[model samples]
Target chain A: MITPITETDLLLFYYQEADEVTTSIIREHLPENTDWQYFLNELATISSESSSLMCSPSNTTLSIILEESRSQLEHTL
Target chain B: MNAPIIADGVLIQRYMQGNQAAFETLLNRHRNRIFTSIYLLVNDRYLAEDIFQETFIKIINNIQAGKYNHEDKFLPWAMRIARNLSIDTIRSRKRMPVVVDSEGRDVFDCLGISVQSREDEQINQDEISALKHWIRELPEEQREVLILRNYAELSFKEIAVLTNTNINTCIGRMHYAILNLRKKMQKNTVRVK
Candidate 1:
């Protein structure tokens, strides 16, 4: 009997957190399931697009952090 | 030949042993993701910077004090500290974060876009701003799950632990967050058309 897939399963599968058996099941099921295929594609597109939305903190903040670390080292010495 | 890339655990060991450069390498490597994660949670640039600084300071202190124990899983461990600090600041302020600054700039305005023609850049910027705005509009729980999963690069299991929810719940929230985002994007596209 075929196991029914949940949206949670699809999500885990997309994130590569699914077990090997579930991964195989999803891989086998995707070819025969257009809806799941579309969902997976949407998940992939969202992941790809959102991954680029990184922003850096200001230089001053970084400088301060490094200075704090240096001070800590001095205290330890 | 290229030098072998050192793992985070090794870098932590070096930093703990008085090698500041190792800590610098670690900071430079994960700075963007850590900053962005805090910014998204707080939705204020200045506040985000403050929290980011605090997060790293706490990390340094923890490492020096021998409180850092998560081996090789540095980003997620740092992210948990960042997340907690952001949440504490938000709760203390007793207000939800706004999507735009006082001058009406987008919270994501600091994100770097690829170089392109002015017109194309404008279009791309507008689209990214809209996407980020939609993300900011999501329910707090859903947005938290999405940010932790995507920006922090935490596994669902880690997210579940961080958020104090079960793994299935984390996965479910992520699924709904993606679906909600897609629906909002589709609706916006229809309106634009």
Candidate 2:
């Protein structure tokens, strides 16, 4: 049986931000681990799906505030 | 009349120079991300909206009063205000914090994954589905870490700064989170078998 994948190794793989050497090692050894495929799929879904949720705030509210701020500034000036 | 928005620092400088249009432009650029983060924290739509408005109000009033500093990074500064206000609201209400990562998905604790039989695709899919369910059940801290790290694409450094914790602690939290999740999965698998 292959050695258990370290959390760090898996993390590097899942993030896919790891260096080439580490990634190559993970790629080379991944097939030996039955669970790696499931992990890979989950990572793919998570990286893609979760990213959309992480963007900064909406522009509508900001526009409203901006309009109001502009109006108030105009009136004052 | 459509054009790219200016940088946050440049916008702040213009606003400080009494340029309302510049300020408005900056607000438009950041509102969604700011509001979404606030909403995620409070978990109440109305409260989140209120806090979102209040945060901008603070920024505007501070700017007008010559109290808002442009040198400080705008995004984190705004987020700090929103986060503090949301945390205060949660505390005052004495409500246990509820994290909603998905629109309609079930919560599952993502501790450690189970030892799955790789030869069975059906079994693997079932295990994965079960894992998703468990991730939803994890505690707020663990769930947030998993979501922020795995989903938010935030660097460990960013998460550490945001959470006011060290990287090792964040990693440990993640480790425990996965361990707990894996244990739960193993138990469930055994039971189902």
Interface C-alpha RMSD after superposing true interface residues, each candidate, one decimal: 2.7, 6.3
Name the runs in model 2 displaced over 4 angstroms.
A1-5, A9-38, A51-64, A71-77, B1-6, B63-72, B95-137, B146-154, B174-193
What value does DockQ give for candidate 2?
Answer: 0.23
Q: Return the TM-scores of chain A for each candidate in numbered order.
A: 0.87, 0.48
Tens-digit lDDT track for model 2 on B1-193?
9877578888887877778778877776777667656654554455667788778878877766767676766776776677678778878767544344466422322322211122133235433344444555677677656655664345565667778989767766776666676577557644212
Error of 2 at B162 (Å): 2.8
Evaluate model 1: give its TM-score: 0.83
Residue B28 shift from truth in candidate 1, angstroms: 1.4
Cα lDDT tens digits, model 2, A33-69, are 6677766654565445433444344455656676667
RMSD of each: 6.9, 11.9
TM-score of each: 0.83, 0.58
